[model samples]
Structures are given as C-alpha cells and as structure tokens.
Target: MSQLRLWGHWPLFLFLSGWCAVAIFLDYLYAGIPGRKYFLLLSGLSALLLGLSFPPFGFTPLIFFGFVPLFYIQEIADRNKTSELFYVYNAFVLWNIFDTYWVANAALLPGIVAIWLNSFFMLVPWIGAQWVGRKIPSLRWWSFASFWVVFEWIHHNWEISWPWLTLGNAWSSLTSWIQWYEYTGVFGGTLWTLIMNILFFQFILNLKKQLSIRKNSRTITLILCFLIFPVLISILIDRNFLAEGKYGEICVVQPNYEPHYEKFAVPEMEQITRLGRLAEINLTKDTRFILFPETCIGDIGGPVNSARVQDDNRIITFYDFIESHFNIPIVMGLTTIKFLRDGELDSPFKRTNQAFKEPYEIANSAVILKNRLEKNIPVYNKSRLVPGAEIFPYRRLLPFLSPLVDKLGGTVAGLATQKERTVFEAGNLVIAPVICYESIYGNYMRGYIKNGAQAIFIMTNDGWWDDTPGYKQHMAFSKLRAIEFRKPVIRSANTGISCFIDARGNLGKSLGYNVHSSINQGVTFSPYLSFYAKFGDLLAYLALLFATFFVILRLFRYFF
Candidate 1:
C-alpha cells in the first residue's frame, strides 16, 4: 500500500529508525536538569517544537517517538535510586512533546513508536515506586497513579498541550472498556493501563525465583486478566449503547480549500462559498446545525474584523448572504480584527515583545449565524493560543524571535477569555463553538456544557500541515469532548477528516484527507449531560493539589 515498496524498504526502515534516534536525543537536550538555570528556557523551546507538530509543520512523529529509548537507558543506568526520579519526570516532560502535536503516522509504526518512547519512563516510576514502597511504605499503587495523572494534567493545559494519546485512548480500540469513559473520562483507561503495567512488571521480576507452578501460574493468570478483562468486557457492552441509539442529524463543511492560498483569490472564494452553499442546500430537514472549518478564508490582513467591522463591510456581506440564503443556522471559524485603542479604523503599528506591535489585531475567532438573522450576533475569540504561530510564551526574553512572531500571521491575544464558555441559540438548539487547537483542553470544553451547550461545534484548519496524525488526533479530541459533555460535536476542517461526533462519542462519518473532497453528514443535538459536564475541572484540580503536596513532601524528605 505504501509507495516505499518500490525502494529497498529494509534500508528505508533503518533510515527511519535512525531519524527517530536523533529526535529522542534532541528531546534529551531540551529536557534540561530540573533545577538548572535554563530549565524553563528549554521547556519553552520544547513546547514550541511540540506545537509545531500540529500543522503547517508536521514533524512530531519521528522526533517524539523516535529516540525515546535514551531516556530509559539513562534512567536505568543511573545508580542512585533517587536519580531515576528526574529521568522519570523527564520522560513525561518530553511526552509533553506528543501532547501538543499529532503526526499523521500516530496510528501506524511511527505512532506506536511515539507512544512507547513517551511511555518508556512509565516503567521508571513503576520500578521506583516498588523500591520506595519498601523504603517509605506509603499508600500502595495510588501514589504512582496520582503522580502520573498530575503529570499528564500539566501538559494538558498549555499552548503546547496534547492530551489525545493517553494510554487510555488506546482503549478506543478496546471499546467495551472505554464505554465507561462516557462516565469516568479517558483517565479511567490510563489508570487501567497503569495497573496492568504494574502487574506485568512484578510478575516478571519474581518469575525465576518462584519454586511452585501454582503461585506462579496464579500470578500469570492474574496478569492476563488484568490485561484482557477490560478489553473483552468493553467490546461486549458497547452493543448496549448502540441499541439505545439517540442520534442527531447534523452536517459539517470540509472546504478542501487550502489557507496558504489567499482566501480572497477569486477562484478560492468561489470554492469556499460554493461549499458553504452546498452545505446549506444538502442539509436534511432534520439537520440541527452546520459547521465551517476555521478560517475558511485564506488571506490574513484584509478581512481581520469580518464579524464586527464597518456597518457596510465585506465581512457582513458574507454573513448577510449566509443568513438570507440558508434556512439552517451556521457556526463558523472566522478571523476578525479589532482596533486596540478604539481609534481610527486604520491599522496602527505598535511594538510589543517585538511581535504584533502592529495596530491591526487578528484574532482566531468563532461566530454563530442564526438562520437569516445577522444582527447583534454572539462571537468568542480563542482563549488559549498556539505558541509559535499564535502567541509566543516569552517573547520579551527572546528578542531574536521578532520575525518568528510575525510569521504566525494573525492577531495576537484574541480576547481575554472569560474563562467561561459562551453559548448561542438556534431554533431551540444551543450551539457552543470551540476554536482550533482548543478542543484538546477538556476543562475548556466542559465549561461550554456547564453553561448549556447541547451541541458542540469545532472549526479547524488541518491543512497547515497536511493529513498528519495532528488532524486525526484533532478529531479524536472532538470524540472525547462529545463523550465528556454527553453532547454531539460537529467538526469541520479545511483539508479533510471533517466529521460529526455523536453524544455517545461515536464517529457518524467523515471526509477523507485527500484534496478537493467535500463532505456532508448528520450530527446529533441533545441535552444529554455527564458527570464531567456538571463538575468541570473539579477532579483535575483535586488531582493537582494532591500531587503538589506529595511531591513537596518527597522533596523535603530527599533534600530539604
């Protein structure tokens, strides 16, 4: 199936493996010492590289998974029992690499490599915990469990954040086990993975010394059950969910028009408008809402403030067209501009951290257009931003990054997000809009449901980097969001894989990553809610607090 078949593939695999080795080595360099002067500096660089893995540059696969064995070797070779702590910490820290970007190959060998490399240090903590279990004797397995989850939570919150590949997501293939995610969230899957890891490690460590077949056989049996029981049960019980199908009809627009090409290009405009028009025309009468990918428009400077610009502006012209022609409400990802000082409409250029000192502000934004009514609409700017491309973390310190900042090519800091999800209504439908890259953050998604969003809308531009796992992982994030909120999610991407996620988190259908493919599919609308929707960030905060205190106490014991 791969074109590589024509090449001497065995050597190709070696070359690919060599590339991975180098990536892992660079990750090591980026993972500076815990208390070093440049620790935060390396961390920032790490996050940028992590975010770059998403789009417009899809290098995440080789670098993230490729060279990870280095960390394992380093941790294992360290003679000091405590020395393993930093290495264990570093592995997850480097794993933050995979969190922010999803390479297209994450489902195949490349993806598996990334997962194993990211998780290699998982064994570090498991071993150290077993050793410390003898030394300090704290609460049993939950200590390591709590440590890992808290570690994951940190990466789950930043610009370079990627939370899609938790060992728990692996259970997506093991449907029966993950069915509980509808109630417990994906962490449940990760927790099970930890338990199995512990069991297997212990079983192997004690294998040769055991004298009798009975004890060893029983341990082996327990290990097998630990690994397989959840998977088997998960597959069987998924049917129960399928039987009580409460599906919705929603459509998503994947305008395969690339953004690097000017959106205002006459031909591009026709194509985008045509796709939106087609979405409007093809909607089933039952379709509750329609979604457009993020910034379906290609050009940056001209249409910055499309939503709330001059009264007779071009932005409004597009809105007026959609409202007048389409009977169904449309939720779209749009880029708009806002004058900073409330001054003249002209672009003012100011210099801040050498980035967007320019007067014209570009924000990655989302707008809701309710059928044929275009006045006084609700809009939300993306709160969290991508580091290199959206908002650089420490631009003030990195003076040389001036050109790099300008390259993100959009508005800096859209709006000071209210830290709350805002909602709008369409013919009894309550639509919540999630901008590109923000869907991966569960806390942000949950706030929308808590505020009353019966259906979720996601707008993204995956073509920035092509059909990498970044796009697939983006879709996976939407699936989890739907499961977490107990509401349907409709995602539209510029390149492909546009899809509708059901309230139950099933993929109804999707568009391919290939060029020029337009997709129309039904999405559901429902008020079905979950524990996570009702109690947003409560569990995450609690986990954070516990890990903080435990780590502090351990630090005191070790050095203070």
Candidate 2:
C-alpha cells in the first residue's frame, strides 16, 4: 500500500519538473523573454502606471518606472527578432484610453479618433529610437530620450498638437518637486524621467544576470542620485524664492452651464445675465478686472465682426453692466468673424457664405470691454486650437477629409489664429488672456511673459468633459504654468475649477465642478521674468539637434 501511494505522487512531481524545465528553457532561448500573455500583461501594467501618474489618481512617483516595462518589451523584441511595434502601440493605446477617455464625453467619434491617432503618433519616436538602436547599438538609450523630447517639441508646434501627456506634466500636482522648472521648463522633467527609466531597467537586467554587487553598486548609486538630487534642488529653490510685483484683485466667475444641454440652448442674454449676477456678487471695490470663461456668450448674434466687436448688442450689454455697476474692465471670450479683404489670397481656413459669396474667417477670441470708448476691441484670437474640435489637421492637403471631420464633430473650416501673444491691459493690470487649450503650452505661455504680461488670466470651458479627471487635469496644468513663469494665474472655467494659482504653484479656493459660483482673489503680479520665460525651451531645441544628428549618422552608416 505504501509503495502504491509513492508511485501515485510521482505523476505530480514529474508535472512540476517538466513545467520548470520549459520555463527555464524559454528564458534561456529568448534571453529572459516571457510568453505572449506575459508580454501583454507587462504592457498593460505600463499603461496603468503612466495613467495613474496624472490627475485624480495622481500616483506621481509611478511615472519614474512607467517606461521600464516598455524598455523590457523592446529588449525582448530586439533579442527574439520579433516586431516590437505591436506591443509598444498596445501600451500607448491603452495609456491614451486610460488617461483621456473623458474626451469621449465631449464628442464620441472625434474623441475616439483623437485617442487612437494620438497613440499612433506617439509610436513615431519609439520607432525612430528602435531604428537608431539597430544601426548604432551603443547610443540606444540616448537616442530614445532624444527622439522622445524631439517628438514632444514637434507635438507642441504642429497642427494636430496635443502635448497634454508630455511626461513633465506629471509633476503638476506635486509642484514642490519640480521648482527647477523655472530654469529648464518641462522638457527637463521629460529628460530626467527617460534617463531614470533607462537606468532602472538596466539595474533590473544586472540583477537578473546575478551580477556581482561590485558591478551593480554604481548603477544603484546613480539611480538614487538621479531620484533624489532634483527633488532636493527643487526644495532648496522653493525655500529661497520670493514672488514680488504689483498687486491686484481679480474676480473669477464659474457659471455652471452644461455645454451640450444648457449653454447654447439658453438665450444669449440669459447667459450674460447669469455671468453678470455671479460677478456682481463677487466683485469688490478693489477688483481690477473681472474674468469670464471661454465662449461665455454663445453664438454672439452670428459671430460679431472682429473689426467692430463693440457694436454687437452682447458687447454693448457687457459694457453697460460694467459701467452701471462697477465700471471695471471685463475680460471675456466669444466668437468673432473677419471678412477677407478683396485682394486677400484664399486659404483653407477661410469659409464663404452661400448667400453672400464672400469669404470670412471665424476666430475663437477674447476681448476686453471697458468704460473708455474705443473704435475696436483688443481681441486675441486663440492660437493653439484643440486638434479635432477646433481645427482639422492637414485640411489643406486632404480637403476630402473635411466632411469626415465634420461628421466626427469637428469644425470643417478651421478657426483663425493670430501670429503673436496679445496681452490685455486694464488700468495698472496687465494679463495674458489664455483661452481654452492654450494654457497647456509652457513655451507658448512664455511669449505672453516676454510681451510684458504681469499676470495670466486663463478663460476656459471645461463642461465639455463633464465631471471627470479631464477638467482636473486641465486645472492642474495651470499650476505648472504658474511655476514656470513665477507669475500668478487666475482661471475662469465655464463649469468648474475656477481658482487661483500663486507664484509658488499653490492652489487657492476654487469653485467645484458643475457649480455656479464666483470668487474674488488678490493676485500679486511678477514683472520680472523667470529663466524659462526668458530662454524658452532650450533643452527641447538641444534634444532636437541631437536627434537630427543621430538620424544623419544612422543614414550615413547605412549607406556606407
């Protein structure tokens, strides 16, 4: 009986032994590469880690290791002679969906296109890095970091520009850790993140090989230094920094109007009246300017002429309200139309009215209405437009896609943009009138500072994303802007998170999401420019130069 029991257990033992052998053999054959399921699982883990590093979830430290799995995947593919594109693309697609799925809440078809298309664009740098790695294996890590930074810089300047996920943005919520941004801007954070991930991945590889402690200690020490040095420097900078300049009281109003159901559905006067009521309650005697959200006045009687914005009844009502009640300058956003000149060359952005047969351009613009009479309002056309919603990218080259863009909830005709940053002046107060989607660009924001903007006023309509992390993430980005320029930021959102960020990137009292409210906050302006404001994305330019040099070398080597 004892002999029979021993034989029965032999099958289980044999099964375990066979499993271990297969696992060990696979690891040896593929240089520690896992099976297909584990590969995908690692990609998913990377996506989750990256997504959690952004707002709401805000596991910021996770960003340091977010790219480690991606490096591992690339290593596996390189060793096993398999295509890494599929797995890399899978990670990016999952990341885009995880972080910005709230975009679908605004427009479903366009939102899906934005997510998938943006993910595809993200693969450009990774693919470039992989190609360079094949040609020049020693510079693989350097090429990866350089290509990514170049990609980010391109994203900020292009027509389909979406730099929201620039790795540097992860520090927005934890501004204390990145006070050095005032000198290097966001690109520095991007480089730091890429380097740390590369080093950490290398350390993991060393451990897997069971390398001697002497060999691994240097990498371990380097990792610790990279992790702690920046934060220590940032803390030191924060401790010594002092914000100084002119002081002014500004009122930010959040009139909780649902963009889909309520904002445009209600009468234009009714919306104006609601804004006035909120401003009236919050306005103080010392308030220098009253800030309103983007497109606060819907339709504006079929897009008031940009040349004669003051003639519009909505503008007249706004001026009258200010004159009668407080006589303070009101900065608000609306749509404006400019008819093309007789000799003006036709452009893809220009549209013609079927009845009039004359070309005109529409702009998502901001204007200031003051008591003083002026022939024309100082209007700032929003320069940076949302990819699908406001402007169709490459519309000129692919006119046939216009209808597709329209069907997907995008403007068939793109909005007009101005060439330079325009700052609005009201008495002693000077502000950068940043419209929705314009606030995210740190280098672009520096233009306002260079143009002599003392404080930044951001006018936005966050209701499109409903009550989700999208609005919160948008709000958090403004904090980074505050630190980058060392200037106070005043925000007025159509539905929520209307608040103030001081020079130190500290958040003040804010109106919650979907609430009709207003708050009066005193902001101290900074006349002096920060290093980032003066120099402007030098790191990005260097990265671009390096990436270009590597590409040239790779091509030369291939031909030779």
Candidate 3:
C-alpha cells in the first residue's frame, strides 16, 4: 500500500518536471518564432518551474533535467549557419538559464552551491558561435566566448540580479575543490566547467574525418582536460568531513511571534517564556552567542512610542527582568519607540514617509541585550526590507496612496527602509547582518563583507510564506552565499529550514521545523576569503561591458 502511494506521487512528479521542461523549450522556440506567444508561455513556465523546485518536491534534483531540452534546442539551431533562428535560440537559452538561477533563489543557496552542473548555462554563446562560426570562421571562437560571457554578465547585473551559476558552483558540487573556493569565488568552477564542456564537445566534433579540424583543438582539449581533471578529482578526494574546530555555545530562539499581536498583546512574560523554554533546551554554561528571528517577540510598536497604549512597559520591562536573570547576551527582533519632535512623538520613519505618521519605528531589526545589562544595547536596523510588507516599491509615483493599501494595521502607518548594509560589532566579532530579502541581493550582501565582516548572520521571517516552494528556494540561496564569499553563515528562520552553512557549503548543525523548535549552532571564522570579496563582481561587470559593446556595436552595424 505504501509503495503504491509512493508510485502514485512519482507520476505527478515526473509529469510536472517533464512538462515544465517542455514548456520552457517551447518558450524558447517562441522567441525564435515571431509572435512572442511562447514568451508568455515561457514566463508562465518559468514561474511554474521555480514553484516546483521548492518544498512540495525537493525535486531540486529534477531542475537539471531542463538541460536536456535546452541542449537539443541549441544543437538543432546550430544546424544551419545562415539561419536567423540562431540568434533567438541563443537568447532563449540565456533566458532559460536565467530562470533556473532565479528559481534557485540565486544568492541564497548555502555552502558551495551545486547548481554548477548547470555550467552549460554559461556556454550558450559558444553554441551561438557554431552559427556565427560558419559565417565568420575567424571570429567564431571569440564571438562564442564573448556571447556567453556577455549573457552571464548581464544576467548577474540586471535588477540587482541573480548570478548563482558562476562556474565556481561546479567545484562546490563536489566538496573537495571547495576548499579553494576562498580563492576562486563560484566563478572559478564555472570557468573550468565551461572550458571542459567546450573542449569535450569540440573533441567529439573533431573525432570525424571531414568535419574534424586537425589542429591544436585536439592537443588543447587534452591539455585543458588533463589539467582540470586532477583538480576536479582532488576536490572530491580532499573533501574530508574531518576538520577540527572549537565549539562555542550559541542559542537561537524563534519566538514564533505573529505580526497581528499588539505591542504588549501577548504576555511578554508568556512570549518571552515560550522562547525561554525553547531556548531552555540548549542553555549551556559556554553559550557564546544567541539569536531570535526578525521581530519575533512583539508587535510593530512597543512601550517607548505608545502612551495610552495598553501594552506598556511590559515587553521591555519583561525582558528587563528576564535579561537581568541571564548573564549572556540575547539577540532578538522587536519594534522600537523613538520620539520624533520636541513635545510630541511620531513614527520614527515619518519624515521619509508622511503617510505612516505613527511615532514608533516598527523596524524589522535585531537587538542585543547583554546579560545583566540594564537596558537593550546596540540595535541593528535591517538594511534590506521586503517589497510589499515593510516597503512599498515604486513609491515615488504613488506616495500618499500606499498606507491605504495595507490589510494589516499597526506597522507605523507608512513604511521604513534602510539606506545601507551595515555591520555590527559585538565583542571581538565583526558581524555582517542580512535580514530576510536582503540575503537574495548578492552585490548588496558583498557590501557588508567588503566593509570587513569576518562572518555573516542572516535573520529571516520565513513564516510569512511557509509550506510552499517559496521557503525552500529562499533557503537554497543561503548556500550560494557560502560559496560566493567563502564565509560561514548562520541562518535562523522563524518557521523552518534553519541551518549553519560553512564556507564550502557544508551544512553543519540544523533544526528542522518538524523535529525541533530552534537551533543554536556554534559558528567559527574560516579565515579564508574569496577573490569575489577582494575584487567584488569584477567578472560580472566585465561581462556586462562586453554585452553592451556587442549589443550596441552590433545593432549599430546592422541598422546604420
């Protein structure tokens, strides 16, 4: 009976995965076709495919199946050199790969990202060159390399972008090459994989008599593959799950606070106790650090801003009592009270957003209350805010109209946004904090590490979108950061999918929603940094410049 049910689910699973790939393939064809009908289908499939990769199916494994159709499409389009069909085909391939990276939550996948298997994602240009190669044989190789490198560059730069498939991901896939990640960034693996694919494909093409080119293409293929193969194999062999590190006690409390509650709505005593209880499970004498999800303990506004507010001095006073009891610092999320004018008080974000005239700054932020301290210590305001909830996008066009668009109340009327990705220093630890959606912004996340962040800690409230593909995709991006920056990540979510990711993408110490309430895993600095960190997205910038040069230069040549 159980086997039958399992088989039953597999049918739908296979169907959805296959259908999504087919839909994407057709979407690609539509771009080559005149009407753009397939583009609509393409967008729809992109959305659907992204949705499928999440929870309902850890079918994250199935995402690669997309490569098959895309592969054939590129192969078929390249059949004739004169066919304009080749251009659209190249564009479509770029889009599909972009969609995959998008579905994977680009910047979020933890540790070294494994999606590098999608390294072909970067080879569309070489495939494009097969057509241009026939027409202008001299420019074939350069064109192809330029084409792919350009697309990748544009893909990573547009709209604060998603550059998850850097060649470096292939190294991440197999743990061994990953140690070198500190030096390469994910792009190193990406470059190696693309070169391998090109060599292998060329080697196979040349295996024939007439079609074969008797050139260094053969020797070059051998040498490149030989040099890269050992590195790839060594990565696998060196992947010793055997590294010794010190253990520092860390505690995480997911207060599971719902947004609807008033500032003092829940008994601060009760809510704090609830977290205290969950936290109680890991109360050790050596706890070096502790955490709570974003704004988990209270409502949007607290005592400092509220006067007649019934939920007075409760949350702060309650924490005052509890914090006084423990000597270790407790890092938590809460709404704060900041008075505005001389005699009167108003929302802290009132100046930038007049509609949200309420006085309390309902910031989704982190606060560290040192054990035995009299008051809450330094507060870290979340620099990144979600599109709809905390912030209203494209607000300049519709200013006064935003506050009225809210279904839930008490968020200080309007909204607040952070102008920068700032770092918080606690003791000897220089921590770069990413709160929620900010994690998805790779370049933005880079700013923190560039400012000297030894380690990264991301606080998220995944509870808003739970049980769906949304959560899983969000978590996967966390892995990408570990690989890109080669830093240890400590992720604490409100609901589930909380885990500690090392620089190499190795997951350490996690708590699933079904089994445990919170996780308090210790984090250590890897002392390693990535070229990406030292140089920033220079490769991506170069790609973008290349794309612009070709796009503008080519368009001008064709038109003028």
Worst 10 residues of 3 by lDDT: 1-10
Better of 1 and 3 by TM-score: 1
- Which lDDT tens digits does candidate 3 get at residues 461-490? 654432334455566667667766767778
Question: Model 2 compared with the native: what TM-score?
Answer: 0.91
Sorted by lDDT (best first), the order is 2, 1, 3
Return the lDDT, model 3, position 222.
Answer: 75
lDDT tens readout by residue for model 2, 439-546: 999998888999999999999988777667789999998998999999999999997589999988999979998688899989898797999999999999999899
Q: What is the lDDT of residue 472 in candidate 1?
A: 65
Question: What lDDT does each candidate get?
Answer: 0.55, 0.84, 0.51
2 versus 3: better TM-score goes to: 2
Model 2 regions more than 4 Å off: 1-37, 298-300, 345-348, 355-357
Error of 3 at 3 (Å): 26
TM-score of each: 0.71, 0.91, 0.65
Number of the predicted model whose lDDT against the real structure is largest: 2
Q: What's the distance in Å from true for residue 389, model 3?
A: 4.6
